[model samples]
Target: MAMNLPSQRGRGRKAPMADINVTPLVDVMLVLLIIFMVTAPLLTAGVPVNLPDSLAKPLDQDQKPVQLSIDDQGRLFLENEEVAETDLPQRLERITAIQAGGTPPQVFLRADRQLDYGRVMAVMGELNRAGLNRVALVTVEGTPK
Candidate 1:
């Protein structure tokens, strides 16, 4: 006397693959990388200053930076919002306090190429006066031949 059960078909076939196929994953990552590479130059800050081109090395991305933009007409902007020249120091202090927690604030200064050299210097002087010592001059990197 024995109990009988229906034998399943293909019972001994190899189990469904447990290994993940990484080919598609790699394909997706490569596509995303190419997209970022193509679009990165288009993503520069929106303030429309014609930055001077230079060979200077770029800043490290790990440090947060505050933007200070000077337009062709000598208008000042803090992160794209118009700012008064008279209010710069207090604004720098406030911004530094909020951003860097007492370390000297890193300011990326962008000035139009047509802007007067003296005006740029005066503005730099203002930033230095406000104790923002870590100033990075933002420039348009020239494309190579």
Candidate 2:
């Protein structure tokens, strides 16, 4: 007597898998990427100043440096904290002392495009008097006229 084996014609296709599905995960990741791209530009914190355009390349800024902002109205800010011109040197000295060892960190200066040349120079003079010698002017790359 011959025994009957299952025929291949009975199973035309393989059974569906019960594995994990990543479509939802991929969709969530894409949404997150788009959200980050939209909000990243607006997250920068600083006193708003229309910076003068330059053709210079951006610096290799990894560490957090002291920031100075000179607005169109000639108002001054040190790392988001407003400081008077008469007392800026004192504040800077205190900050330098806080750093303690090693050379003082460089200052990133952002001045408005409409600010007077003299005012910017005056701030530099005061910065020099405060022993903050390394100053880097921050400007955006200009577009063609």
Candidate 3:
């Protein structure tokens, strides 16, 4: 029986080469995809309102309308930024003043389902008194459960 010795090893053997393994990259990409899928729905802007649905198609405005949210606590938010009730009129005036020369700026009200109807109406009235008549209610698109 003949035994191979280390000194008799072939010199034709090549050393292992270094390269980036893409398996980890693929795994990270898949994880990122899953994270986005889970969070995308939560990124939408709106008060938690069980909006009344209608068969009518959604309306598209020429310019981005101002967003006003009324939460269950009766707090008012202008474009996701909390606004003092007293400052609302002044803010609306300023916003409308900027667009005075152009088309009247529209106001979209997103009131929580649990909010008082009177509170929502008062906000609309304030906007109207501030000379912003192009107002619309924001609602989801589905039948009430």
Count of steric clashes across candidates, in order:
0, 0, 0
Q: Which stretches of candidate 3 lie over 4 Å from their true place?
A: 1-20, 61-63, 114-116
Report the lDDT of model 3 for residue 139: 79
lDDT of each: 0.85, 0.85, 0.84
Q: What tens-digit string does per-residue lDDT give for candidate 3 at 19-109?
A: 8899999999999999999999997785565556655568987888888888888888898889999999999999989988987788888
Select the stronger candidate by lDDT from 1 and 3. 1
Q: Give Cα distance to truth, residue 36, candidate 3, Å.
A: 1.5
lDDT of 1 at 133: 85
67, model 2: CA deviation in Å?
1.1
> In candidate 1, what are the lDDT values of residues 30-99, reduced to their tens digit?
9999999999988768679988888777767766788999999999999888989998888887875676
What local lDDT does model 3 show for residue 114?
81
The candidate that wins on TM-score is 2
Worst 10 residues of 1 by lDDT: 3-12
Tens digits of per-residue lDDT for model 2, 1-145: 9965555766655555679999999999999999999999887756898888888888886568899999999999998878888878888898778766877888999999898899999999887977889899998898623
Clashing pairs in 3: none
Worst 10 residues of 3 by lDDT: 3-12
Cα lDDT for residue 137, candidate 3: 91
Off by over 4 Å in 1: 1-43, 99-102, 143-145
